[model samples]
Target chain A: MNKYRIVIEPGSENSNYWKDLWNYRGLFYFLAWRDILVRYKQTVIGILWSVLRPLITIVVFTIVFNKLGNFPSDSGAPYAIMVCAGMLPWQFFSSAFSEAANSLIANSNLLTKVYFPRLIVPASTVIVSIIDFLISFVILIGLFFFYHFIPDWRILFLPLFLLLATLTAMGFGLFIAALNVQYRDFRYVIPFIVQFGLYISPIGFSSTIIYNNANIPDYLKFIYALNPMVGVIDGFRWCILGGSSHLHIPQFIASVGISILFLFIGIWYFRKMEKSFADVI
Target chain B: MRNPIITVENISKSYILKHQNNERYTALRDVITNTAKSIFTKQTIINNSKEEFWALKDISFEINQGDRVGIIGRNGAGKSTLLKVLSRIVAPTKGRITIDGRIASLLEVGTGFHPELSGRENIFLNGSILGMSKKEIKNKFDEIVDFSGVEKFLDTPVKRYSSGMYVRLAFAVAAHLEPEILIVDEVLAVGDAEFQKKCLGKMKDVSSEGRTVLFVSHNMGAISALCSTSIILNKGKIEFNGSVDKAVKIYHNIQTTNKNQVYTSQGINKEIFISETYLKNSENENTLAFSHDEPVYVVIKFYANILLDDLLLSISVSDFEDRKIFSSEVLISKVLSVDKKFGEAILEIPSVFLIPNDYKLNVGIHIPNLQVFDFIENICSFSIVDNGSEFSKYVGTDIGCVFSQSKWAII
Candidate 1:
């Protein structure tokens, strides 16, 4: 007789979960592919929307903050370039986070009808963000050419910063996705988070403005670093706008530590709530 | 003997059914306010009602290799819950299920098909969602399209396809899946009758290849045709587990309505009233169970305070779903003189006319298209058992409820 392939009992889902995730990688890829395909299906703009959204944001922020407000670009990089650097990572974080937050409820039909790692649903939404990020990265390359700004060896670390932004988004996205399944109020809560997150994060202005100020206290700076995206935006500017955009190693470490902690917390809470998702959903 | 392919031991699942409100979702405000009320008031909230309803309780069963098992039950009987547990869609609240081979369950068809995706894209997307690897779907791609007969529309988005074509494409992809064990829950209920028959035929082909199949459906015809062994669930517990015939028999017994088996009319004032009604076999013995080859009679006895004329006595037989199968009527004046105060009517349903299923009998004596003198619906019920008929030799052949021997010559 063949050996027993699967033994299912209460909490058996925890055992071999990572291995099951590995086995179901095809589903992960297909789910991501499905979202990517459906994202731009009927729209005439199609993939161009990915490029246009961030470009328009960069143009509008440059006018409001750089041209009108006359904010000093201490990095010696063009004010528009500095804002573009911050805006790219911020766009990726906001969209990926929001998408991941609603991923579970959006795929509730699959949750009830099929059995695969529930983690795949939210994780796949991140791929959509990655594709959008790659598309919008083209605009930043265009800015580099227009400004004749030659990048240095430090630019090789851009992927590491992108990875940071992804981890940060996924951490909060998974937590919010699971919570949204039980309490639909989280649905209303997500747009508010994305909206409020844009202003608080150092997107329109530089983190250096606050860190360089003599009036702001150290404790306030530390609390600002607690927002994981603050580290991601700082990292992006350090890599892309590399003149005077200093990477604060101490604050960077603090932010990275919090992002990892949120990732674990998100996974822990997601697994805890995953068992009842099919039933409740 | 081959080892059991699936061993389920004491598996159970329960859900906390909240009766506080009809809302399916919780709001943060409600949770916060309820917490505040509970913490400060120090008294239990009257409106907070939580009841744990066990959908499956201490159920245990083992299925061997190459067995086609049908799970038959009324609604709310936990058949779906049991399938959900076995397939690992939802974990059982207690106990365990050990399976020896790859199992794919179809609680629904087209589970993750995106309407905006083309038919070809959805095939791969849905196949992977059902646990098929990409290479496996690619290998079976042509066969799936051929089976669905929607090859011409492969490039078109599925939203544009007709509903029939959509279901065909979905079911075709599912049929090509080569799992060692397949668990399906009423996915065959979709599509037209011919499509349903085709789906059942494909399922039989799957089981014939020595794959274990667990099927849950309310359609007894499909159940009897496909499954060799069956399990009957009642109120979240296994009521019976045995051959398909006996399982279906027990299922009918469980579904037997709350109406009195031997209906006795109340003394509602009328010119005439049915006093008693029941079913009897060919031997004139009172039996609710009858063989498919034997005649069953509906005996209704009524009392009239005054002589009546031109009374039409009708007996209608309906299947388990309450669909009227056929009705037989006789004019009391033509059969026997209605000048007497007491009269008895026996409607004989001939042998081999009704298939193996539970059927209800509605007896009424009424004027043509006018007032009902004495009428009783679902007065009695009876079942026709399959006792190794010639058609029983073949598996998965659904000869519908009504059958009769008609003269035929095949050259």
Candidate 2:
């Protein structure tokens, strides 16, 4: 008798999930590349859309917040450079979330007809979004040269912030994607969440604006820092602008903790609901 | 002499179906009212009115290393659900299935192909979906394209290929990406007859190489030709698990007996009514038994109170599970010849084409020209059974369905 048995037990989630995913790594790459090709194909502007999207947002934010609201920029650094830094990570998170939320529903044909790791669907969407992030990062570098801003040694922490943003985006993306499969109303809710989230996160202004305005209570500021994006945006500006807006240890810890929490909850909720995806989708 | 390669123990799957008629909201107001009601009274809070159905109930079977197994059943009999569980696409509500070797399934043709991607790219994409490594897919790329006969269209996106070309390519990719066990579910029905034959030959070759094959199809001819052993599924349970010939016989017998009954239904608006429908042999009497060369007639009797225009009568011949094998439709004005007070339509099917196995007839009435009448769906069914004939010579006893009569000369 063969020692290894591939048994499918109903109503029981497989314990060896990591092994199964490792085996399906090829599918992950296929889906990711497929997404990349489909998005770029037949478009007049082609890959420029990736850069143009974030650059346009940076322009709108720079005008509205810096000129109208009189928000402070990182000391001596141009407002465009400061906003572009925040927009890069924020665009990565929002695009990843939107695409991941719709991944399973969009691939209903593949899910119902074939068997591979269901996680590969959402995971591949995140990877596709990462490709878009790399494309848009080039635009960020151009803005850095135009503004003549030089980064400090703290810029070494950029990779940590990128990882933090990716994890946070994936966590939320998995949760919403799983929910959208069941409720379908999540499709409508996602755009609103992305739009609403843009205002709350420090994209156009530095966190110092909120702190210098003393009308807000101290405890409220502490709770506001718990939003996770607060720490991420502040950290990006500190690292890129080369200023005293150093990494705040407590807020960074809170952001990392919340990201991990969301990741665990997302995976659990996704696995629980995955069984019904084929039937309903 | 070999140990079993696949073992299934008491596997069962149940599905919950939410009734569409019941409208319950999960809104805050509704939740609050329901909570208040539950707090005030000693009663269950939620309504458990949705129906639960067991798709597979306590089914168990085993297949040896080199065995070719066929699963046959009527629609809703859980054949596809069983395959889904076996492929690990969906988990069963209960029971377990264990297989020793790598299993590749072609549950549906072109399962992972992107319409925008060229056939060449899709081959690699689909190969990976079937669990082939990149190097393995590269090695077999030429053979896959040759077998599918889509080498010229390899650079064209699959969406541009004709449906026949699409299925041929999809099946070719699946067949060449060799796995220890192969599971195919009724995919052969999509392609032309010659491609289907090639697919059947490939499946036979695979089984002969000491690999296991699990096939689910309504085509009894294909099943009998390829499978050494067969199982009959009836309403989510295994009815018979034995030699291919015996299981096919049981399946045909069940279909024949069930199709002999007449069907009729009445509605408030009596624009049309289904009176009687049945299947009969050439003797012009309703019977389940049929001869090899005899004509199988589908007789339908219907009534229309007012003078009807553009009324269409359609008939389909399907296997036990309602998968359409062949269908035809006739307009009333074209076939009626004269306006009649009452109507009877008969569809004749010539034999020698359908392999000897159980078959069902589905009758439909529609008003394609008028657009005013409610389309009557498959209103009735009947069966055909084949008598002993020489057409069965090339076929083994295990083979089911029609054996095409073709002559071969040593040229």
Candidate 3:
């Protein structure tokens, strides 16, 4: 009996897996298309549901938060525009999180039975969510015209902000997806995290509320920006609204640092959990 | 002719079976007691016993270009683990493996086929998964659809296809993938008989084109027909790695010897226990012997705890790989009288059906729709040595499950 054992070794950052991902890029497109098709399959309105979902969210938030709670918006931008801008990143993150968390378990048939780069699973979810983000962007443009808000040169940073939000979502999404393969409890915890994340992030209210309150110190303001979405939402508001709520340099720096930190940590944790995925999943 | 396509060294893999502890937080009282115990003794308070299982154990083999090798093993014998390590789906715990060419694996049918996608779309999707380029897949698109026989359903979503159609399309894409090396598991078990025959033919065509093939299957008949060499694995270790006939013989011997001690009966009425079973030559020669296209007989002795009625004698014949060749049940309701006394019964297998190969016999005594009285599975094993029969020429080698004598005239 030859006692051969496979010791757990950490994967190097420069392994061929990245190159494999590149080679399997066509698979990424196919899976993204499949996700889009499956999402609208057999529905009465089909692709309209993609635009209608976020549009309905904007209307409900405007009524409940703006009309009743009296939530303050940016200086000149209407409440609908502010909510739509905030909703963009929020929807992208939540949708990406839910999709990626279920990616491995949903594709257990493939994972257990086949040999492909496992990273393709979560990577495809991020791609699929980007399609949804683009569809919902039409409503954002509609609100932009209705509110009569003019763009600034800072609007060029919209792609940068979208990339940051994508990285953050994929970072956490990959880790949670791998963990959910073993500990099924993460499946139940993910929806709660997404819903709770909406209230904690400055989606419904403006980040200016944190600045105007005197009870908090200036140092705490820098710490508050550690939540990566604060800078993203602020950047979106700053870019789209073109108002006094400009990007705070410290908050932006904090956001960039935290986003990178999540990206690295998420990859590390996900790679650690990947070894057991084929068996347990 | 070319460089060795797959060079697998001493590769091994181990898996942790269970988690030891899952508690996130410990009580203060429990922590203080554990801390005191740890201070007094080197042993920890928590008894964490981890069980590690090595799925593959120091297996080393090399496959050359154009070589078709069949890997045969029972379940949990590390066959899939070895393939996974070679394909880089799972890293080997110890040792190393190097391959010189692109490898495509059909470990399971419909592996990357998204049900929501159309069959035409899934063809490109599965092709790319096997590492074929878009242009290559497009060039072979019509051929794939024609081979799968799903041209009418090309635009229909694959989720709507029956399992047979799905497997046909999936296998077509994988079989047509023009990789330098092809690895396939027991995916042939899913398709219908005709489709399975088509897959076997395609595999033969692939291997004949100077491409390497690594096949894993329990069907010894298929392995013997298709592969030039074969390896047999047992308990995560290679038991035999040589000629397909020799490997099949070793596998069958081990299987029969292992099952000789267990007895089980089901779906019969009478209460009886099969005391023992054995096979001998027809002349009472005392040694297991039979010739190709000759009658083979088995003798079963047993004692009945209670008398029974409507007794039926059933026997299942399987090849060296434990794949069932044929089965028959002898109902004694009309042909013969039921003997209520403790005695022996002899079953005879007629000639010219089973090909020249090793086989095992499973015998059972059952009543009509009541319960099994006495049953012995794999009770006796025998081998049919070939003697230059006419059917041997069509098989190319004495390597098929059935040997039927028929003449073909090209009129």
Candidate 4:
């Protein structure tokens, strides 16, 4: 009974927010489960689309950059394998970021009707993206077998990079989702970010191309690392290609710092705007 | 005495009603242009379009355990805003509410139901959205399915379901929620009449189990049948809060007084017009309120500029919710053979015919099936008080709109 006692006042929810999140964990899982189930319901290919999207993209990148353009593969691993490794995290980040950004408006009915942690909506969308990430990861395993390339002990550190990518996606996702509720203009902004981020971040090609090329200045590389996906993709390549792939410690730290910083900023802005979501949305 | 399970203190909510050319949402382009205009023209454009409207103002109330409280109000009278504040869907602009025990609010049926999800899946999903634990939903799964009567199509997606089946399935999940307090909006308005009755009965059972229930509905019959106490809200303030009978009576009075008792066609030019209309008693005195056992007369005076054949005058008596009780139609030629240029039509509704409630009249002059000369909706308003009739004793049970004097014998 004491656990159930609730005091509701203007902005009084801040004190019980995390506890509410913990209590509504069931709703969190159910929403994620519902989205996953519904996503594949009507389509014939269904879940296989997750795998096909990244596999096809990586194949095109390999042909365009490696076979046709004669670009050097800095990692020394097969260009297809290197591209596949980076593509997995990039796909996960883009899909997760976009889906989480629009999740609040998509579930506006629930926003106005029920009392739960509003964070659950965007958080659940990230989980859906994680499922897609896992499905596409299957392609990476297939690439490994086709090339007969064994990843070294560094491969075990892959979960650490995945966690970093999740944080980066969530930070941006939560920020835009809350802004979308208030300004609705952010809805158009999200797809643009995804499309632009895909090109700016190192996914189809390697980050080493920019670092090793003398024509590109040092400050330019620093600005490029500011895009958190640069670090995430580079980290994935390092884990899969082992010691041969250069993990630039300075750029890596810069990216990690930015990811954590965005996470805090996103959460701060989201919490500030969450209480008014029902009214404005 | 048991302590009150819920205590609200001077709660108020105000919204900034932005007059943005009727757009429901503000666009960034508008904001940017407004900012640019302000900078260039040296005038603030945003403040002129903003006005603050208080949906609720300084409302205070307390409810003891096991109380069934009904909230009654006209449209936009802050009823929904109050519910949203109490349910924590939206925070009040000021003040506090302290509540004991687990509280669940069903502001709408099928709130989070996915159209493509199976009925079985929706039940689980909806149960959690309503604040039930997964295990709790699992335990009540069978009962929900059985109550909804959708056992044969449990695996079928709800998009394929008939609307009746969908509402039932959604309501079944809500009904099985075992919260200490339940707040329900006008969800009972859906489904068929028999299902509505069942929902009222189920709510009564929940109240009997020592759980608190707060209901908002336009159906006065449902409110009287289920709620033990009631609150009447008028323009964001509490007008009255006490026994259900008194609250309902106050609501009835509020409706009639808000409109005109005597209706007249002021500035309209028509072929036929109802010049004046009013309700009168036996002594030929005009009145807007009546007891259940008193005969009432609706007098309508009309003048026809051009005499024509096939003129039918209809007087429809409907409740505040616009549910028509009955409409009486009279063909002018069949009833009277006098001059058709000027006439008066009087409708006598006998004693014991109407139940105790507020009602309005819609007077229309039209051809039998062709055209309408004049149709005035809510031409006048009237009320029939309880008068301590036999139906008054069954106040917390469904007392239908019409009264019957038929005799019954025990077998």
Which candidate has the highest lDDT of all?
Answer: 4
Tens-digit per-residue lDDT, B1-411, candidate 3: 555666667777887654434443223445467679877998865444446899998888877888889998899999998887776666667776767777778788877787878999889877876778888999999999999999999999999999889999999998898777888988777677677778888988999998888999876667767788888888888888897766665676565464443233332554565555666555665334465546776666655655556767777988767899988876543433345445566777777767877677777778867887666666556776443354432332444687656677898
Query: Candidate 3, B115: how far from true, in Å?
Result: 2.5
Residues B238-294 of candidate 4: C-alpha lDDT, one tens digit per residue? 999999876876787677676787888752778677889999977797777776777
Q: What is the C-alpha lDDT profile of model 1 across A1-281, one tens digit per residue? A: 45437889897546788988998999999999999999999999899999898889889988998889987774799877888899999999999999999999999999999899999999999999999999989999999999999878889999999999999999999999999999999999999999998988988888888888899999999999888988999999898887767988888898999999999999999999998899877
TM-score of every model versus the real structure:
0.87, 0.79, 0.78, 0.84
On a 0 to 100 scale, what is the lDDT of residue A249 in model 1? 84
Per-residue alpha-carbon lDDT of candidate 2 for residues B9-110, written as tens digits (9 for 90 to 100): 999888776553343322334446766887788664645535789999999999888889999999999999999888888888887788998888889887
lDDT tens readout by residue for model 1, B217-334: 8777678778999999989999999998767656665666564578887648777778889888777877677767789988888776755567778889998788898988887744
Best by DockQ: 1
Better of 2 and 3 by lDDT: 2
Q: How close is candidate 2 to the true structure, as a TM-score?
A: 0.79
- How much lDDT does each candidate structure score? 0.87, 0.79, 0.76, 0.88
Lowest-scoring 10 consecutive residues by lDDT in candidate 4 chain B? B388-397
If both were scored by TM-score, which would come out higher, candidate 1 or candidate 3?
1
Off by over 4 Å in 1: A1-4, B46-48, B262-350, B355-379, B383-401, B407-411
**Tens digit of per-residue lDDT, candidate 2, span A75-193:** 76888888988898888889898999889989988988888889999999888888898889887789778877677898898888877888888888899988887666788889998
Q: iRMS for all predictions? A: 1.6, 3.3, 9.1, 1.2
